[model samples]
Target: MLQIGLDAGGTSTRATVVTTDGECVGYARSSGGNPISSGKIGASSAILDAIESALTRANATLSDVSVIVAAMAGGSADDSRDWLIEPLADRDFTGTVAWESDLLATYFSGTFSSFGYAIVSGTGAAVIRVEDGQIARTSDGLGWLLGDAGSGFWIGHNVALAVMSDIDGRGPSTALTPRLLEALGISTEGARVQGRSPALPRLITALYDMRPVQLAQFAPLAFSEPEDAVSRGILESAGSLLAHSVEAVHTENGPLVIGGSVLAQTGRLAETFAARLAAQGIEPAIVRVADGAVGSAVLALREAGVDITASVFRRVTDSVARMR
Candidate 1:
C-alpha cells in the first residue's frame, strides 16, 4: 500500500508518496494560497494538482494509494481531514485520510519516545505540546494579526516601525534606515513616503528588508556585530516569545524541538532561545527537523497501519534523508 502526505505551507504545497516500508516513491510541489481567504474550492484545486503531480511521478495512480494525510497551515482537526474524504468520496481519489495541524504531524513523527514541545517558526510561529502521547496544550498560532511572534511577519513588521520612527526623527538613527534606502535604490525619504501612500502597499513591501535580519540572512545580521539595535531587539523578542510559548505548556521537564526555516537556518535564535528557557529553569533539546514534509509522510504511514517500532522509526528517518 502507498501513503500520500501533503504539507500545505504558507507559500507552497508539497506532496509525497511513500510505501508502507517507508521508501519515498514520488514527490511534487506547487504554489498554494490560503484556504481561509481563497475559499475551499480554490484551495482544493491547488492541493489536487500537487497530489496528481506526485502520484504521476511515482508512476502510480490514486487507486493504488491506500491512505492520505495532510498537514496544512490553518488546517484544523476536522476541516483538514475533510479535504481528502470529501474529494475521494466522489471517486476522484481512493484513500483513508486524516488531517492534522502541521505542528502535530511533525511532533508525532519525531520525539516519539518522549513527551515534549515543538515550536514552528517560519512565515509565522506556533507552539505545540505533546504529553503521554496526546496534545496537552497549544499557543499563538493565530497568524500575523494576533500571534506569530518572532516570525518573518513579525521581523518585517518591526523593521517597518523602526524605519518610520527614524524617518520622524523620533528613534535612534540606525544603520538600517540608510542601508535599506540604499538597497532599494531610493535617494530620499520622499520615495519612502510615496510608497506608503494608500495606493502603494505593494511597493512599500521591500521597505521592510532594510535590516539584515529582515533580509533573512538570519545569521550575519542576528549574530555578527555591527548589527542595529532594533534588529537585535526583534530577534530577542521573537526568541523570548517562543520561549514563553514553550514555558506555557512545559511541565517540570520535557524535550523541546524547534522546527521551520527560521530556526533551522539560524543558530543564533536557537542559542538565544535556550538561554531564555534556561532562565525559567527549563533546558530544551533544540533540534531542527531533518524533513518536516517527509515527517508528515511517516505520520501518514503510521495512521495507515504501520507499527511505531524502533525499526520503523529508522526506516522513516532513512526515507526522509534519502528524499530530502
Candidate 2:
C-alpha cells in the first residue's frame, strides 16, 4: 500500500507518496496551505490540490494509500487537523491520518531518535518537545507580531529599532544604520514642510511598507560583522532566548535538534546556542534539515504499519537522500 506525507508551509505545500518499502512513488508541490497563514478555505484548497497532484503523478488514488501524515504551520492543533482530515474524508479517503506541527516533523526528520527538543530559528522561532511521535509541549513561534523572541524577524526588527534610536540620538552610534538604509533603498525623498522634518520619519514609513518576510532578509546582516557590539548583543540575546525556550519545556535529556537559518548557519549565534544549551546540561546532535518534507514521509510510514527498526530508519533516510 502507498503512504502519503505532506509538509504545508505558508508559502507552499509538498506531498510525497512512498511505498511501504520506502520507495518514493510520487511527489508534487502546490501553493501555500498553512491555515494560520492562509485562510481556512484557501489553505484547504491548496492542500487538496497538492495531494491529488502527488497521487496522480504516482498513477494512484487516495484510496490506495494506507496512511497520511501532515506537518503543517499557522493553525491551532485541532483546527488545522480538521483542515486536512475533513477535506480528505470528503474525497472518500479511509486511511490513518496523523496531524502535527511542522516543527515536530522537522525534528523527527533531523534525527533517528523518538524523543528530544527541536528548536527552530527561521523567520520565527519555537521549541517543540516530541515524545514517541507526539508533541508533549511547545514554546514561542507566536509569529513576528507577538513573540518569535529569538527568530530572524526578532533580529531584524531589533536592528531596525536600533537604527531609529541612533538617528534620534537616543542610542549609541552603530555601523548598521547606513548599511540597512542602503539595503532597503530608502532614499531622501522630498521632506514634509519643505525639508523641515528630519529623515527619521520617512524611514519609519519605509520600514512599515516592508512585509515580515521582507524584513527577515536582513537577518544575515547581524552576522556580517560578528564583532560589532550591536550584532554581538543581538546574537547573544537570541541564543539565550533559544536556550530558555527549550529549558522551559523540561524534556528528558535527548539530542537538542536545531533548525532554521539563524541556528543552522555557521555563526556566533550557533556557537552561543551550543554554549547556552551546555549550561543546561544539554548537548545537541546538530542535525541540519534542508527541508522537513521527508520527515513527514517517515511519519506516514510509521502509521502505515511499517516497523521502525534501525534498518527501517536507514531506509527512510535513504529514501530522502535518493529523492533529494
Candidate 3:
C-alpha cells in the first residue's frame, strides 16, 4: 500500500508518494495552492495536478493509496476542507484524508521528534510550538497588514519607507536608495539629478500600483549593502521581532526548526535571530528544512500506521532527498 502527502503553499505545491515503509517513490510539483493567495479554484487545481502527476510517476492509481495527508498554508481556516474535498472527489479518491497546517509539516521536516518549535519567515512570519505532533500554540501569523513583523514583506515595506524618508531628507542616506529606484525601473541618475521632488511622486505611484504582498520583491535589497547602517538596522530589527515571536511560544528544550527564505538564507536576518536567542540563554538544537513535503510524507506514514523510528525517518529523508 502507499500513501500520498501534499504540501501546499502560496508559492507552490508539492506531492509525494511513499510506500508503507516510508520510502518515497514519486514526486511532483505544481503552482501555488494556497486558497487565500491563489483562490479556491486555482489552489485546488494546482493540488490536483501535483497529485495526479505524482501518482502517474509512481505507476499507481489513487486506489493504491490508503491515506493522504495535506499540509496547507491556510489549512486552519474554517472553509479550508472545501479546498480538499472537491479535488479528491473529482478523482474519486475515497481514502482517508487528513488536513494539517503547513507549520507542523515544517517542524516534522527537520526532525522525527514529535515535540519541537517551528518558525517560518518567508513572505510572512510565524512561530509554532508542537507537542506530541500537534500544534500546541502559535504566534504572529497575521497577514501583512496587521503583524508579520519580521517577514520579507515587513522588511521590504520598511525598505521603501526608509528610501522615501531619505528622499525627503528626514532619514540618513543609504545605498538602498539608488538600488530601490533601479529595481522600480526608475532611472537612478535621473532621480539623483532631478532631485527628490520628481522622484518621490514616481516612487509613491509605482509602489501604490503594486499589490501589498509584492513589496517582498524589495527584501533582497536590504542585504545588497553589507556596510549600510540603514539596511543593517532593518535586519537587526527584523531579527529581534522574529526572536520575540519565538520567545512567546518558548518552552522546555526541543529542536528549533527554521525555514522559509528570510531565515534559511544564511544571512544577517538569520544571524541576528540566532544571536538574540543566545542573548537570552535560550539555545536548542536548530534544524533547517528547505522543503516541507517530506514532513507531510512523514505524517502520512504515521497516519498509515507506520512506526516512525529514527531508522524509518532516515529512510524517508534519504528517499525524498534522492527524488529532489
Candidate 4:
C-alpha cells in the first residue's frame, strides 16, 4: 500500500505519494489560500484538487493509499483542522489521517525522529520547540504588525522602509538604494512612493520569483567597503532573531534544520545564523529540504506504520536527488 503526505503552506500546497519503502512516486502543488480566508468550499476544493493531481501523477488512486498525513502551518488550530477533515472525508480516506503544524512535520520528517526544533522564515515566521514528542513552546507568530521578525515579509518591509528613509534624507546611504532603483528602474523615491510604485511589488515578487539568485546578489550589499550597512543589518538582525528562538528550545543535541526560502536564498543569512548558533553552543546539522514536499511524503510513511530506518531516509533523499 502507498502512503501520502501533504505539506500545506499559506502560499502553496504540496502533496507527495510514496511507497512503504520510502520511494517517492509522485507530487503536485496548488495555491494555499486559507479556506476561511477564501471561503471554506473554495479552500477545501483547492486542497482536494492538489491531492488528486498528485495521486494521479503517482499512477495511484486514493483507495490505494494506506495512510495520509498532512503538515500544515497552524493546522493545530481547530478551525483549520475542521476545514481540512470534511475534504479528506469526502475523498473516502478512511485510513489514518494525521494533521499537525508543518514545523513539527518538517522537523520529524527531516530528522527522521520525533524531537528537535524548527525555525521557519518565509512570508511570515515562527519557531517551534518540540521535546520528547510534544510541543513545548511556540513564540508568537504574529504577522508583520507585531512579529515575523526574521522573515521574508520582515526583510521586504524593512527594505522598503530603508529606501523611503534614504529618499527623504533621513537614513544612511547603502548599496540597496542603488540596487533597488536599478532593479525597479525607479529614478526617484517620489516616483516610486507616489506613482503607485511598481518597484515595491517587483521587489516582493523577486523574493519569490528570482529567489536565491536575486538574494545572492543582495548579500554583498549588507557589508561596508566590502560591506553594505543596510544588508548587513538585515542579516545580523534576522540571525539574532533566529538565535533567540533557538535559545527557547534549550536543547544541546539536535539535527536542527532550517526552513523557508530566506535561508536557501541568502548565504549571508546562513553564515550569520551559524555564527549566532555557535555563540549559543548549538551546532546545527543543516539539511536543505528543497521544498519540504518530500519531507511531507516521509511523514505519510511514518503514519502508515512503515518502519523508518537510515536506509529508508536515504531512499527518499535519493529519489529527491533524481528529481533535482
By TM-score, the best candidate is 3
Q: Which tens-of-lDDT digit does each residue in 1-324 have in candidate 3?
A: 999888999989999999998889989999998888899889889988998899898899888989999898755555647667867877788789988889988888889888889999999999999998889999998989999989999999999999999988999998899999999887534434445557888898999999998999899999777579999999989999999999999988899999899887667777889899988877989999997888999989999899889988898899999987
In terms of TM-score, which candidate is stronger, 2 or 3? 3
Ranking of all candidate structures by their TM-score, best first: 3, 2, 1, 4
How well does candidate 1 match the true structure in TM-score terms? 0.82
lDDT of 1 by residue, 1-324 (tens): 789887776557778888888788788886663476546676677778888888888899888999888777676544555544687677666567777677866675566554788888776788888876556788887777787877766765665566557666678766666554554555553345543433134326555435433443332333332356776776677678878878877885666667776667555566677788899999766556743576678678878988666676677667656654
Question: What Cα-based lDDT does every candidate model obtain?
Answer: 0.68, 0.79, 0.89, 0.68
lDDT of 4 by residue, 205-320 (tens): 54556543234343333432226777778777877776776777666566676677666665666677778888878886766654567677767887787777878988876775
**For model 1, which pairs clash?**
none
Candidate 1 vs candidate 4, TM-score winner: 1
Clash statistics: count for each candidate: 0, 1, 0, 7
Off by over 4 Å in 2: 77-91, 188-197, 211-214
TM per candidate comes to 0.82, 0.88, 0.95, 0.80
Model 1, C-alpha of 90: deviation from truth (Å): 4.5
Residue 241, candidate 3: alpha-carbon lDDT? 97
